[model samples]
Target: MADGSNGKPGQGLLGDTENHARVRTTALVIIAFAVVLFMLVQARFLLISLAVAIILFALTSDVIRFIARQRIGRFGVPNWLASIAALVLISTALLVLSSILLAQLNTVLVTTVSYAERAPSAVASLFGWMGEDVETAVFNSLRSVEISGYVRTVAGQAGNLMQGTVLVILFVGFLFAERIWFDTKMTNFFEDEGQAARATKIITSIIHRVNYYLLVKTVVSVITGAMIYVVAQVFGIELALALGILTFILNYIPNIGSIVATGMVALVGYVETGDAQTTGILFLITGAIQFINGNVIDPWMMGRALRLSSFGIIMSLAFWGAVWGIPGMFLSVPIMVMLLVVCSHVPELRKVAVLLSREGLPEDEQELDRLAEEIENRKG
Candidate 1:
C-alpha cells in the first residue's frame, strides 16, 4: 500500500507511529503544564515561601560550610552548629527586614490620601505641553478613579508579608535540618554513582550562578536605593525612607523596575509640590541614578554572569507577575536562571535553554553539552 515517494511500507508505518507518539506526548505536556499552573496559583503562598527558602539556603550554604571548616581550640565547628547559627541569623534578618518594610509600607499608605488628592492636577501638568485640552482630559480621567480604595487594597495585601516571613523562616529551618542528608538521599534515589554525581553538579551549578547574581544585584541595588534616598531627602520629600526601600525592592525586578521607581518618585514629588520644574528636576536625578547603576555599574559587575535576554526577562516578568503578582515579579529572574540551568543540562531541553539565554548559548557551552550527553547516555 506504500506509494513510491512515500517509501517502503515499514518506513511509512514507523513514521506514522512516531507522529502519533509525538502528538500524544505534546498533549500530555500541555495537560501537565495546565495542572502545574493551577497548583502554582492555588498554592502560591507556600510555594513562594519554599522558593525563597531555597534561594536563601543556596546563598548561605558556602558561608555555613566555611564556618563549619574552622577550628576552635582544636575542635572543629560542627555542621549542625553552623546550621543553627545561620538559621538564627536568617530568621532575625527576615523578621527585622519584614518589620521595617511593613513600617515603610504603612507610612506610604497613610500618606497616600493627601498625595492622591493632589495627584490629578500635578500629573496632568506634566503633559501641559501637549495642550490644555489634553491636560484637562487627563485630569478628568484621573479624577474618575477611586485612589483610596486601591491604596486600601494594597495595604491589605502588604500585611501578608509578615505571615509569609514566618512561613519562610519555618521552611528555612527544615531545609537546614535536611541539608546534610541531601547528597546521601540523592545518591540513594539515583542508585548510580555517576548519575548522582552529575545531578549534584547540575544543582551546584544552579546554586552558584543564582547566588552570584543575587550578590551582585544586592550591592548594586543598595547603592542605587541609597543615592535615590539622598536625592529625596535633599529635595525635602517627606517619604524619603519609604521611597528608598521601595527602590531597593523594585530594583530586584530588572529592566522595568527602575523605570517604575523613577516615575513613582516624580509623581509623588509633583503631587506634593505641584511644581513642574521641581518634579522635573527630581525625575532627571532619579532617572540618572537608575541609568548609571543599571546600565553602567550593573553590566560592568555582572559581565557574562547573567547572560539573560532582555526580552526574555520582560516576558518572565509579565508571566510571573500575572500569575503571582508582585512576589512573582521579584522572583522571576531567579526562576528563569534556574530554568536555564536545568534545561541546558538536558540534551532534549537544550533548545529551550538557548531561547532563554542572551546569546543563544548557556554557560560553559561545551561542558553543558558533555554533561547533557552523559545524562542522556546514562538514561539510555
Candidate 2:
C-alpha cells in the first residue's frame, strides 16, 4: 500500500550495490591478469619452447598427414612411422643449422669485440673534417657503451638459445606423439559433436594461416639474406657469411629487425673499411634489400591472410619481447594470429578479435556488408 516514491530509494540502493560489485569484479580481473602476465614472464623459457613446438607442429602436420596417406606397394605408410620420420628429419636439420649458427655467432662475437677499440677512432676519422669538439664528442658518445657488456649479453643469449633448442626439440617430439590423440581429446572434451567440429575447424584454419605465413617469411628471408650476402661479397666486406646468416635470422623479427640489420651492416662496414664511402654504400644496399623484401615481397606473398592491425602487432611485439626477449619477438605474430582466431570464435571475445583485426569488422558485419552489396547490385 506504500506510494511509488517510497520504493525509489530502495531501487537506488540496489543499483549502487550492483555498481560497487561490478567495479570490484573488474579490479579483481585486472589483478589476476597482471599476476598471470608476471608468471608468463618468469616461465618464458618453457612457454617459448611450447610455442615453438606448436608452430613447428602446425607447419609440418599437414605434410605428415599427406605422407601417411601415400601408398607403397598398395600399403599406406603408418601414421606413427611418418611422424617419426618427419621428426627425425626436422631434428637433424635443426641440429645442423644450430651448429652452423653457433659457429658463426662465435666468430662474429670475437670480431665485434675486437672492433670495439677501433670503432670510436673509425667514427672520429669519418668526421675528421668536422671541428675537433664535434669529433671528440662523437667519439666519446660512441665509446661510452661497453663492448664487454655486449659480449656478455650475446654470450648469455647464446647459452639460452642452446637450452631453448633442447627444450623445443623435446616439446616437438612430445607434441608429435600426442598428435594422434588430439582429435579424440577434442571430441571427448566437447559433448556436442557440432561444437567439437567447430573447434577443430578453427584449429585447422589457424594452422593454415600460420603455416602460410611462415612459408612466405622463410622464402623472403632467404632471398634477402642471399642478396645481402652477394652485396657483402661484391663489396669485399669482412665477415660476409656471418652477416648473411645474421640477416637471415633477424629477418624473422618484424619492423625492428630490418632496421637493426641495416645499421649493423653499416657499422661493421665502417669499422672494417675505416671509410665513410664503404659504410654509406653498404647501408644503401642493405636498406634497399630490406625495403624490397619487407615492404614488397613479404606483403605480396602474405596478401590478406593475416588481418592483423598494425598497432596490435606492435603491442604484441613489445609485450612478448619484454616477456621473453628475442624469441618472444619471433613468435609474436603467430601468437597474435592464434588470439585473433580464437577470440573471433568466442561470442564474448568477438570484440577483442575485432580490435585486433585490421579491418575492424566481425564476421556478422562482413556478412551484412556482403548482403548490402548484393542488394545494391540487384537494384542496379
Candidate 3:
C-alpha cells in the first residue's frame, strides 16, 4: 500500500516474484551439481586416473618446455624429440620407483601383519591390571582379521594402481602430442584473440602453481620421511626404512596423512620394544616432525602459491577421499587449485572462486561495484 516510483500497488509483489525466480534457479544449479557429482563418483576409476594424468602433465609440462629449449650446439633440441626424451626418462624412472615401492610395501605389509600377532600381548602388558582373559579376547578379536585376505586385497589394489599408472602414461603422451597445436586450436575456437590469450594465461597460471605445489610438497615429504627414519633408527625401531617410505607416500594426503603415519610408527615402536616409554617417545618425536613440516615448513614454502582456503581444502580432501579413496586425497589440492583458478576468470563463477580462496578477496566484484557507483555518482 506504499506508493513507489512505478506508482503501482503490486510493485513489491513483482520484486518478490523476481527474488523467488532467482532462488529457484540457484536451487536447480545446486541439484544439477549434485547429480553430476554422483555420476563422477560412480565412474571414479576412469575420472580419477584422468585427473591424475592431467595433474602429472601440469607438473612436468614446463620441465619439458625447458628441455626443449636447451641446445647442445647451434641448434636447440626439437620439441618432439625433447618430448620423447622427457617421456622416456620419466617413464623409466616411474617404472623403477614403482618396483622399489612395491617391494617396500610388500615388506611393510608382511612385517605389520607379523606384528599384529604380538600387538595384543604388547597392549596387555601396557595394562598390567588386565588378566590373561582380556589378552585372549584382544588376540581373538585381532586374529579374526585374515591377514592373507588383506594382503590379497592390497595386491589387487596395487595392480589397479599399476593400471592407473599406465593410463596416466598414455594420457601424458597424448597431451604432449597435442601441446603444439593447442594454441592454434584456441585461436580458431575464439574469435577474439585477446580472450584466447587470456584463456592461455589462465591455463599457464594453473600449470605453474600446480607444478610449484607438487615440487615443494615432494621435497618436504622426503625431508619429513628422512627425519622420521633417523628418529626411528635412534629409537631402534626395526621397520625404520619401510616406515620412512610409508611416511613419504602418506605425506601426500595432507592432515590425515601425518596422523596415520605417526600412528603407524608409534604402533611399530610399541610392538618392537614392548615398552610404553618407547612408544610415547616415538609418538612425540613423530608428532613434532609432522608439526614442524606440515605446519611450519610446508606453509612457509607454499606461501600464497595455492591461495586456497584451509576449510575448502579439507572439504576437497573429504569429498575426493570419499569418491576415489587415497588417490583422490593425494590429488585434492591440485584439483582445487584448478577449480579456483578457472572459476576466478569466469564472471559468473567469480564469487565461488572468492569463497574458495584463502584471502576471501573479491577483486573482480569490488572493481565492478566501484565502477558502477562511480558512474551513478557522475550521473547524479
Candidate 4:
C-alpha cells in the first residue's frame, strides 16, 4: 500500500524475496565449491589425521604454556620445544601400546586357531545340548564365516598402522611449528592492526574451547581405559592391555563407543576362555567403566563447555563416518563442537545452534515478565 513503484511496500517485499533467494543460492554454490575442492584434494585420510593431530597439539599446548608461565625454562620453554616434547610423549605411548597389542594379538590368534581346530568337537557338543537344529545352525554359521580371512586383514592393517602413526606425528610436529607463528601470520591477513587483534582474540577463544574439550575428553578416556584394563586383569581376561587401549581410543567417539568396546572385549573373552560366564563378566565390567566415564566423569569435566545436543552428535557421527570412516567418527564431536561455537556467536545462526545444543539460551525478560504477570493475575 505504501508505494506502487517508487516506494511500494509490496515492491520492498519482492526485493526482499529476490535478495533472500540470491543469498540462499550463493550459499549453496559456495558449499558445493567447498565439497568439490575437498574431493579434488583427495586426501581424506590425511586431512582427518592432521585435524586430529592439531586438536591433540592444541590440547597439550595449554600444559606447555602453564609450565612456561612458571618460568620452568630460561627462554620460557619455546613453543617448538613444548610441541616436540608433547609429540615425543605421544609417540612413545603409541609405540608401547602397539607393542603390547601386537604381542597379545599374536598369542590370541595362535590360541584361537588351535582351539578352533582341536575343540571343534567340544563346541559342537555344547551346541548339541541346546538342540540338534541349533547345533547344525551354529556350525554352519561358523563354517560360512571365514575367520582366517578376517585375521589376515587385521594383521595386514596392524602392520601398516605404524606408518600411519609416523605420518600423524610428523603432521603434528608441523602444526606445532605453525602454532608458534600463527599469531604473526594472522596479523598479515588484516590491513588494520586493530582488526587483526580482534581476529586473534576470536581465534584464541576458539582454540581455548577446542583445547579444553580435548583435554577433558582425553582424561576421561584414559580413566575409562585404565579401569577396563584393571577389571580385565582381575577377571583373568587375555589381551587385557590391547582391549584397554582399544577401549581408550574408541571411547573418544560418543554414544556408541562403549557398546563397540564392550562387544569387542566380550568376543575376546569368549575366544580366550570359551566360557559364556567369563565373556558376560567381561561385558559387565567394560559396561560399568563406560557408564562411569560417560555418565559421571565426562559430564563433570565438560560442564557446559560443549553443550552439544545428543541428536546432533549422533548425526555428526554418521555423516562424518560416511565421509571419512573411523577417523571421521573420531573427529566428528570436535568438529561439531567447533561449528557450534562459531554458530553461537552469530544472531541468526544462534537459533540453529540452540537446536543443536543440549539446552536452549536463557529466556527473554519480556517473556518471563509476561508469565509472572499472568500467574499473579491468575492467583487474584
**In model 3, where do residues sit more than 4 Å from their true spots?**
1-31, 127-149, 362-380
**Runs of candidate 2 exceeding 4 Å displacement:** 1-7, 127-130, 362-380
Residue pairs in clash, model 2: none
Off by over 4 Å in 1: 1-18, 365-380
Error of 3 at 220 (Å): 0.7
Error of 1 at 353 (Å): 1.5
Ten consecutive residues with minimal summed lDDT in candidate 2?
363-372
lDDT tens per residue, model 2, 1-380: 15344556577667778999999999999999999999898888889888988898888886787788789997999999999988997788777888899999999999988888988889787777888888998999988989889898888888777677878788889999999999789989997887777777677667767887899999999998898899989888889999999999999898988888888888888888877877897899799999989999899999887888989999999998998899999999999988987888788999999999999964443543444455346434
Candidate 1: tens digits of C-alpha lDDT, residues 164-248: 9999999999999999999899999999988898888788767767887999999999999999899999999999889999999
lDDT of 3 by residue, 268-355 (tens): 8998998898799889989999999999999999987788898999999999888888888998999998898888879899999999
How high is each candidate's TM-score? Answer: 0.91, 0.92, 0.85, 0.75
TM-score of 1: 0.91
Order the numbered candidates by TM-score, best leading: 2, 1, 3, 4
Clashing pairs in 3: none
Decide which is better by lDDT, 1 or 3. 1
Each model's backbone clash number: 0, 0, 0, 1
Sorting all predicted structures by lDDT, with the top scorer first, yields 1, 2, 3, 4
Error of 3 at 89 (Å): 1.4
Q: How far is candidate 2 from the true structure (C-alpha RMSD, Å)?
A: 5.6
- The TM-score that candidate 4 achieves is 0.75
